[model samples]
Target: MGIKSFQGPRQKQTVEEIPLRVSDYMTKKLITFYSDQTIEEVISALIKHRISGGPVVNDKYELIGMISEGDCVKHISESRYHNSPMQDMRVKDRMIANVETIDGNMNIFDAANKFLSAKRRRFPIVENGRLVGQISQMDILKATIKLKSQNW
Candidate 1:
């Protein structure tokens, strides 16, 4: 008899597709601060909201700058050495004026790339020159984990 070939079951792998957008993953419940707000108030707000920092907005809700824990640290250190109180320090004095913003329609992959290329932990999502939401590195990580789980 001729040699017999063994037949094995063929398995078809299924691919999972997940299209993620910044708006879908962004934190809609934003805790923003005003430029005129005192550093003491900003610090209290940050602690109350359990956030490292947030965008500084104007009366029209336009993103004017960004205030972060790092900025606060600088002010605190200087105030300690100068024997000055931080209560009078305004958010605008320590806020980063040159703010970089992202659009809500941006893809998660693109947002990941942007995070890799920058030192920012979060980006404010803006639409029509107004603050809409915020996206953080944690958000991107969660989206990636969700995508991986869907494949399993």
Candidate 2:
């Protein structure tokens, strides 16, 4: 017979439930940089993570801007071939402000719609007014393709 009830004391995990939302599908362990972090550090971070860009967060964990590979390339070009003092440049001085972002609770349709309508390929998922995770065009496309193939 299937044991219907537990005779011993039940155990519970201390972890809380994160509301299943677009945020849930996002990459939780985000690789981010600070405004005061050097350009070298930023470039190294992007290369190390194999990502195109990341959000720049402050001490309060609030998203202030984003730095992409494109931004770095443009920065280098604008410097007139000057050798950047590795110790001088900071993320804030080179980051793209007014970046596009979305909430985690939004669905894939919304994410896709944003990508199509807004012309933005990546999304920083936020929760409680704080940066939580990131989702990119690749992630969305992968999800779409995977789901479509499942029934085929």
Candidate 3:
């Protein structure tokens, strides 16, 4: 007599496409700053919004640089040392002019890797040289939580 197999017919596995792009988890509504704005104004906004940093843009809303609370603090220290008035300082003077940006279509995993490699807490998502949104470490963590429940 021939041996019988115990396995039954296998069913097709349907896996859901995970939403893992930078755009999928980025914050679209951003509180941006203008380069001409005074550092005091930036500091006020930062305090009001409870944010550490923000992107600096021109009149066209194109990203030009980034300003952070640390930048403002540095300005304060320098101004005190130089005997200069803090009211005269502008965001453009203390902002990080050389800014790095990421693509919106990039995978979130890759973005996390980027954040790790670059030692950045957030990355600006740009498309066609225009600021679209921003992705932060918290966003990546949120994505991770969502993916974890989906058998990631």
Candidate 4:
């Protein structure tokens, strides 16, 4: 006796191409601060740009550390408690020296995973040890949305 094979309906599979690199979604126009800059000045720039924090670069635009609102708050608290002037505080003293950075060529998915694991809201995108741009959680979300909206 011969058995007949059953055939199911053929389904079309679509593959979506996503922008793979962090550089694709990173913001090139960055608001960076210097280590020697006063905490007050850094806070002013952050408020003016409406940013939570930024990367601290040296004279050669090399990433050294990061300064954030949390750092500024700490400075404020210390100054208030000690009755010291906030103007004397510098970014280098308040900024995190061991900064975590990402490369521009890093995959977006990898960057997203890193963001999920870390408490940081953004990551500085560096190339050749130089600060080129910055990538945030929102940037990854925006890129994903754009990729999903594309016609397959």
Give the per-residue lDDT digits (tens) of candidate 3, residues 41-132.
99999999999899998888889999999999999999999999999988888999889999999998999999999998778988888899
Candidate 2 segments whose C-alpha is farther than 4 A from its true place:
1-21, 81-87, 149-152
TM-score of 2: 0.76
**Model 1 agreement with the true structure over 1-152: per-residue lDDT tens digits:** 89988888878987655668988899988889998899999888888888899999999999999999889989999999999988989998999999998888899989999998987899999888989999999999988887775642
Q: Could you say which candidate leads in TM-score?
A: 3
lDDT by residue (1-152, candidate 4, tens digit) is 99988888888987755677899999999999999999999989989999999999999999999999999999999899999999998898999989898888898889999998997799998888899999999999988887776642
TM-score of 3: 0.89
Number of clashing pairs per prediction, in order: 0, 2, 0, 0
TM-score: the better of candidates 1 and 3: 3
Best by lDDT: 3
Residue 152 CA displacement from its true place in model 2, Å: 13
- Model 2 misses residue 137 by how many Å? 0.4
TM-score of each: 0.85, 0.76, 0.89, 0.85
Error of 4 at 63 (Å): 0.5
Q: 5-123 in candidate 2: lDDT tens per residue?
A: 76798788675543334654678888888998888788888888898889899888888888898887777676657865545778889898888888777877678888899887578
lDDT score, candidate 3, position 106: 94
Task: State candidate 4's TM-score.
Answer: 0.85
Give RMSD to native, each candidate. Answer: 4.0, 8.8, 2.2, 4.9
